[model samples]
Target: MAQPTAAESWSGGNEPMKAEYGKLMMWFFLVSDALTFTGFLTAYGFMRFGHEATWPIAEDVFTHFPGIEGDQPLLYVAFMTFVLIMSSVTMVIAVNAGHQLKKTAVAWWMIATIVGGFIFVGSQAWEWYHFIIGDKGGIELADGRVLKVAEAQTGEVLSLSQLVDGEAGHASNHLEKFSTGEVKTAFEANEGLVLQSPGKGHAQLTRTESLRLMQNAQVVQGANMKHNEYGQGQFANFFFFITGFHGFHVFSGVIFNIIIFYNVLLGTYERRKSYLMVEKVGLYWHFVDLVWVFVFTFFYLV
Candidate 1:
């Protein structure tokens, strides 16, 4: 091959940019990944805005968790968000160490990043557990009403009549029992309860609760706990599909990081005299984190 002249080197280089071709490819991949995330987020916004009246308020919907009593709105997700963000920081440190050719430093940061990723996944699983299996679901009634039990000063869920549809000298109506067994019962039937707002209100029960209510004579005879009190069926569907897909990407990224971490320990990149592998995987990992940020903001925050 012919050597390039100094003029060619300064102008249109016979050489590539300071970054290798692999790094450039990683950039392209990240841009495309960003667009994919944007599409998902835009679709979410469109659907949510499209049904603003009926959409769930994220905080009210996700307030409680197992083993911890009382309202802790968005608590689980907030922890997951912090974990993922810290993992991103560790990943940056690893990338910096790669640039400095410090293999052990890179491995240390990568291990920390992996630990953060695992913690994030664990948090997500716990959140899902609360969502899928641990909520105390409830019901609605006719005459534009719904009933939830509430905690009275005595430490018990007050009858619907006590909370909103107060019987005497009350501004707002306390929750009223659907006379003659009209409202469906919740899971455990006696788990601690709180009355969510009416059908027009934003709280939601899970699929199981929805189905259970559907089968009940009260709801079947005619109560409004029908298809989706928490969110539209389409909304729930998209939420699961999009978020679950993004989570799978995070899982894959963790695996990729593990492989790269092993290679770094084995001196593979050192033998090549290039740290491009670490850099490339780092780009992918950051893309995963970026997607989660949008997911957290759009789905849980706003």
Candidate 2:
């Protein structure tokens, strides 16, 4: 057999690694997207480690569950991670079915994958809702430190309404904000409540020190780009940006899966005698799932 001429090689007759153009392009896109996520997670790691002492603990911040009361740290997030991973598993099955030309199996597995994507996205939205709403209100000092009101004996963080005597009027941001005078007055009246530092160690102050700190503090409830009740403002900022970005990717993958699913039902691939489109979307889905593993580890587990 004669080797191909240089002209033939240059004319795109040679395929690198025996991959088709579409598969290679999908790989390229995934590589670029992986880099983008790496950059964001790297920035997050630097900031988090730089302020490790004062940074919010993932468990403490994500303690809420849908129907359960009290703190269930890491449980709900674990569920979300499990669902996403299962979706990736279903994608694998769908791809395998496509390879075998089993149309019915492919369609069913794709539906399962789509449902899993929807569940994960919905769960993330719920998580974000709780994060923005915040668990307990706190006071932000002039130096940007947050001091939470907690029971002196139990160390349980308390909301502003819990510290105040009566109904705290709702503010525009859905969190009740009180004037400095009102907060001071309420603090002076409560002997059991103490101001606690937002560190991992959660340092607390005596009654005298708490009162002095309350004098110049401002009430902060919930989280936004500028303020966070949990801890540092940057924590909230990164949470919103990184998670929202990932969620958007998942949402886009779902849309892609739906389009491909419809095509499968219409026998588009059957007529062509190829299920390459299903395999392509499966690659994207797996990439999204793999990225989430890293995000989950860095943001929640670690």
Candidate 3:
């Protein structure tokens, strides 16, 4: 009973447990996924910079709109971006409500997030359809070059319908050799559409150049996995890969959100005395939204 023992530090409990085990694991997964995305974007950057010339113009390539006529420029993508951003905000509200143990608020915010995700996914699918269908069809030349039929003065690209007297569907194979009166007649009929060629970073053409190039050429239309009407095969390849990957992420996030939404509705979090799952999923949703912004800026806007 001599000297009183000095009190030791309280090291019995885990002090650094701000998040639960599942939530912490989710964070680790997200970090790894982010690295994967960074790698893909890096590869795309290398390809884009390496093949500076003949790269397709994003604006000219993605000019289609929904339920509206005429070229809407980047209107659709802009709307998608807005929707995704709003979803991120809703996720924030959801996580905040979860922190406060408010089941009703969390459910509503999660539903809003789910709705936004559905709209985004649907829009992307529609965009993919139009991309596959293509806008104004063009031909790929024998020399691995693309020739677009565009307005002589305005430099506006023309659809196959406009060029071939309202021919709706795609006409002629890319490899089929065709050079004679048909092209000449097309030239005569559509005086406005000149043979346009792609430049270093943009699609450029002149009436004189087009008139000369159309002399010996084959006819083709649209784009595919192997070919692109705009220019360079890489554009289509990258477009499909990156967008499809992001779409998959969105679809997965939507599924997770639906599960969480139902759980909230059923009072699962309340019974468990914790709503941390919502917060964890919200982290994932926020990460997805951030990735989309980077993709939009680099691939579309830039």
Pairs that clash in candidate 1: 148-195, 160-175, 161-175, 164-173, 164-174, 165-173, 165-174, 165-175, 166-174, 204-230
| Alpha carbon lDDT at 124, candidate 3 | 95
Ranked by lDDT, the better of candidates 2 and 3 is: 2
The predicted structure with the larger lDDT, 1 or 3, is 3
Predicted model with the maximum lDDT: 2
What is candidate 2's TM-score against the reference?
A: 0.90
**How close is every model to the real structure, measured as TM-score?**
0.70, 0.90, 0.84
**Candidate 1 or 2, higher lDDT?**
2
- Ranking by lDDT, best first? 2, 3, 1
* Runs in model 1 lying further than 4 Å from the true structure: 1-17, 65-67, 138-229
**Candidate numbers sorted by TM-score from highest down:** 2, 3, 1
lDDT of 1 by residue, 246-270 (tens): 8888888899999999999999988
Task: Give a tens-digit lDDT track for model 2, residues 1-302.
Answer: 46778898788767656787898899999999999999999999999889876788788788877877666899998999999999999999999999999999999999999999999999999989878886667788878887788889999776677677444322322355656677778888888888887767888889888888777788887889999988877999999999999999999999999999999999999888899999999999999999999999999988
Global local distance difference test of model 1: 0.63
**lDDT, candidate 3, at 298:** 88
Candidate 3, position 74, lDDT = 89
Question: TM-score for model 3?
Answer: 0.84
